[model samples]
Target: MALLNQDSDENPTPGPPRTTEAQYVASRSALWSGVSALFTDGRGRVVLEDVDYRPARLLPGGAIDAGEAPSLAVAREVREELGLTRTFSRALAVDWVPPGAPGYPQGFPGEVIYVFDGGILAEGDFARIRLPEREVTGVRCVEPALLPHHMGPGNARRALAALHARINGTGPAVLEDGRSISPTCLDDLEVLRTPRKPQLWPWHTGPAPDELQVRQSWGWLFSEDGRGLVLIGQDTGSACLPGGTVEPADHDDPARTLRREAWEEAQVRISDPLYLGYLHDDTGSQPCARVRYAAAITDWEPPSLDEATGQTYTRLLATPEQAAQLFDWDSQAAPQLAAVRAAREELGLPAPVRQQLTELPSHRPIQSPAVR
Candidate 1:
């Protein structure tokens, strides 16, 4: 067969050359890609770089070189920016940002940012960080709740979402303009966004003294597995055990208060509320005793709005160790560990291995009974 060529025709004049698919695609709009990593200290604070040229702090990373893979780019950036040699094996999040976002000037192309998991930095690792004065002037470790103070709205949101995605142990979360495309359980509850009040009060394995008033009651309500229940506050987003202050209806019994509050707050029915000692909280106006208990979740109905908080509490299952971390008990680790051991023994739960927190998704809403 003869080759078909318009230019070969006797009467034909030359026309513009046809463009291939690749050539046409190359002419279309392209998004710039930047790579960053999420590093945390032992206390779960994120490591952010203070860029000299930018007002807001940013995650430790930089723009990817042309034709560079994201993983390689992040590794290079870490070495150049933080003066640390590290390799990121997994991505925590991928955010698609539009033009005109912060740090992107008008008419600038959009970007896709890859946030990799930098893993927990130990004391030795922190000691090794050397900031290159030209770009990153300094470094600061900010608590997840305080991220907004240091970062722009979009960057803060993206960083928080990435942290929760790592805690959930799920694959990388996909985001658009720094919002989750499909919100995960942690995202839905807005975990780590709330500043959790420290519970460093002295934990006593002995009985609570009678002179001190019992003002609060909380439980490590366990499921069939070794996981305990945690309630994410609707108003404040703080995570706590599914219990509250002692109501008049509790009749001076802390266990009764725990059972009633668990039912009212999370539609959970717990049984065999075993005493796990008390925390002597003296920070308030007067010294008060906050009794703790360990129990098994016997049954649970669909979750409804907590009459007290006026919104449904996001319920999660976590190991006692995870609960301690969420409650910010770093300084009280010894007591917290003792309490966990007590809870496991009392609830007959085997020693718990560290596991990711998971949600108790219940769509059907039931009427919350009056506090009793």
Candidate 2:
């Protein structure tokens, strides 16, 4: 029987309410937005959230409510998700995810996400974390190296870019999709490289990335007078800095390698090592990153390298002008030399020592190439 006034042979229900086409269009025209907060644990580890209903891990924060500010929305989500009552410190970045990604379901529009700095958590705050069982299944502290696996490409970029901006004090960053605009902040950005032949320092294809490459560490030994130390190759009469490959025994510590190299090549004890930076070299089939450090000679003994294996070196000190003349601006040692001056100036040390042109070391440099 027809329920509503015996209408035809089909059963009918109550009429539904409706909205005008204008209202529908107004809603679809503007894109949706959300926010996430990056909470780290004093250490370089970040807090990642595992949603019960999703496969990918996300930062803790969510959607904006009607007529609510994004900042307020993020604070509310953080409160709801982490069981805390706190707002974000400030926004770290803004990323716009355009529509038409295959990852999204059919007809699903894209979104703009704002990432806020959730300030490093103290020990007490970390202990108080309580995940909402309905939305969050688990929470884990992810190291910097492991972030790429949890957060998708876009989010990982946002997190890392934000972290770098914070560390380098470069202010808030801006990203579209996932890459930095204008001044890219990649730490290993190749601005200067040695002009070695055959393959050259900066590969035509660019430097090989960290994951699948080898690393070498060196110490730019310096004195208070801004004089730098060099090790003269006994075999070839070439002048070069003290450094060597990052052996597996060093346990991935560049500083350790620097200390070991200084001791092995020159019998010099360098203290207070400050990492200057690196040069990404692709002069060979195996890509290499020559990590440079600045250190002051605390004490020294006679230079030592076993002559039995054709590995003997003599330590020599060069004034800044002389060193500059020795390893010109285009040499691989340029960054380290420049860094030595910058570091000394930044530290408010005395200016580099000046020496006459005749004081320059007279050495036949057959080949002073980067350590293989």
Candidate 3:
């Protein structure tokens, strides 16, 4: 009966006997990808979504559905999440994040993320953000510096890379594990370190032109070809423009203060410094207003050891895009730099060449006390 029967007791009817050994799985990788946007408002603050599940924030995107293109996925996400019917900017960055990458949720189902540039949204556009009550709790458009505070390290690095790509006019920046693999990445990218000293941030307080206490001066220096000059500090390894505090003896012109400091520190003679704008230094115990000037640098002298910091300053040349990256990305100096660029453009000045990855800091002047 067993030999004649079509179905056996141990084996299912008309099928091969089940094996005790585990079924073989294909030795292939199933990587999932998604698209996100670095949406900025007129003020240049990036848009982030705060979720209800965890404290970590995220860019406005989700997993790429099967049979969907990345670009299409981003457009869908923005429309669904932010309720905006729109097109996406060029792909600003493409990152290959492994499973369990920082910024991904538990059960993150992907190996790559495509970050797109969602060009600056006006204030009206910012007000248009409507969150899906089930997923996101609230939305925030804040300065780029606070990205790390809101999002995970991986997401922050990738977003910054996308910003760099958009500002410098470079193609998508490629990265792995929060570090860039592309050769054009910024030389002084401060992604590797954590805050050693606490910044005394007053939370988006714009500079008070009339109610300032101290006066400091910095120069917006350019080369003959119009590339900007950047100074990298030896002691702190921080990037800053070449300039310093204003003394009572600096006379009526803050540019003279810059000139004196330039000569003393970098050993360069500053040409005529036209005041671009002023930045409020709000990171210290004492708040001050910083005066900025735009000028050309000439007659270089080898830098001496900075007596104050006891570390030697390294002088380097950078383009406008480069200078923007070299400085603190979310500093008040950003507006001054933009003003200088605008004035130059209006005057038909030569444009600078971006030698490496660009950085996009916000150009929107901080309008109100808490509007940043």
Candidate 4:
């Protein structure tokens, strides 16, 4: 009689395996969970749901049903958990764990957790807000800075760290060790490295005549990640944050100018503008213009094609590291990159993980100048 191959056998003789009935639990039997970040009024105050005996103050989130999209699951969970109408910002993070991981409730042999940034609309009386009392015991709005003191173990800290980056800007911060805190929180600590500057030609064309000078405009610095500002492209070789000159038609509202410029350049529509600060650069000997604004973008959509030019500008979403790489390649954007890094650091943003790329030799390999 032919013998079964032990490695391929479906039912090989049991040895040290199957020590516990739970160990025999099929992976399919695992439950998936999601976490959410509820932003109230764009102030970076996030609502964390208190689940039964989980020992962590978590974002309002829950499990994804089999075959469900994580993004959809998070939105559904937010509504179900908070009983408030809301819309999610971009997906923030995804985490997975093996079944029976400590801290997870028993019977969850595996977990695929998704986290999203969301906004709450139509805030009702706290007493009237509906939640499944069995699963969620309470809901509280915790400031990003203060979350470390009250969040539950493990994932809560990671979620809070992302939130802090979203709120305070991107940079490094300290996280409590898992030995004394949840493993999820321990993973929240991150370091931001200096951005890499790009190489390109200078921005001076020997001062354009005043008649040809573009007026300085201002706009809010918004980001899809809620971390940094978005820049629009101009005739200058580099990219520029969305803002345009104060035209006679602008009606003296810099905020309106920002909105119009965003619509025109990036095709983005923004509401509820905030003031960041002013930036003036005349190094190029071009007409001097100063921009006054704040970096606060709560929502945005991708750019649409220009009806006239049919040209589409790319909207890049990057961490500080990636931005540095782009800046190093594009000379015109060097100043803007410096300004962004400075602004982020001055605002106490978390440091990014910095990696240095070695500089290439100045001389090129010998080759024919042209095949022609």
Highest TM-score: give the candidate number.
Answer: 1
Worst lDDT run of 10 residues, candidate 4, spans 185-194
Better of 3 and 4 by lDDT: 3
For candidate 1, write residues 73-149 as lDDT tens digits.
99999999999999789999999988888777788688999999998788899899887869889988887899999
Expressed as tens digits, the lDDT of each residue in 1-372 for candidate 4 is 233354564766755443333444433354555555545422224567778866767766766777877677777876787676555656544555556665666786566555565643324535456887688888787544456666754565456544433433333232332121222211222211112222333343223234433456555353433344434232221333467677778886666777777777665666555544343354576635444454444445556664434555445344443433223333344454555556555544544443221111223235568766
Worst 10 residues of 2 by lDDT: 190-199
Q: In what order do the candidates fall by TM-score, top score first? A: 1, 3, 2, 4
* Clashing residue pairs found in predicted model 3: 164-358
Count clashing residue pairs in model 3. Answer: 1
Ranking by lDDT: 1, 3, 2, 4
C-alpha lDDT of residue 239 in model 2: 48
Off by over 4 Å in 4: 1-41, 52-55, 87-89, 120-128, 132-134, 164-372
Comparison by TM-score, 1 against 3, better one: 1
Residue-level lDDT tens digits of model 2 in 42-114:
4446788999777878889888888889889988998888887787667877777767643466765777788
User: What are the lDDT figures for the candidates, one per model?
Assistant: 0.83, 0.64, 0.67, 0.49
- Each prediction's RMSD over C-alphas, in Å, is 6.7, 19.2, 12.3, 16.9
Provide the global lDDT of candidate 3 against the true structure.
Answer: 0.67
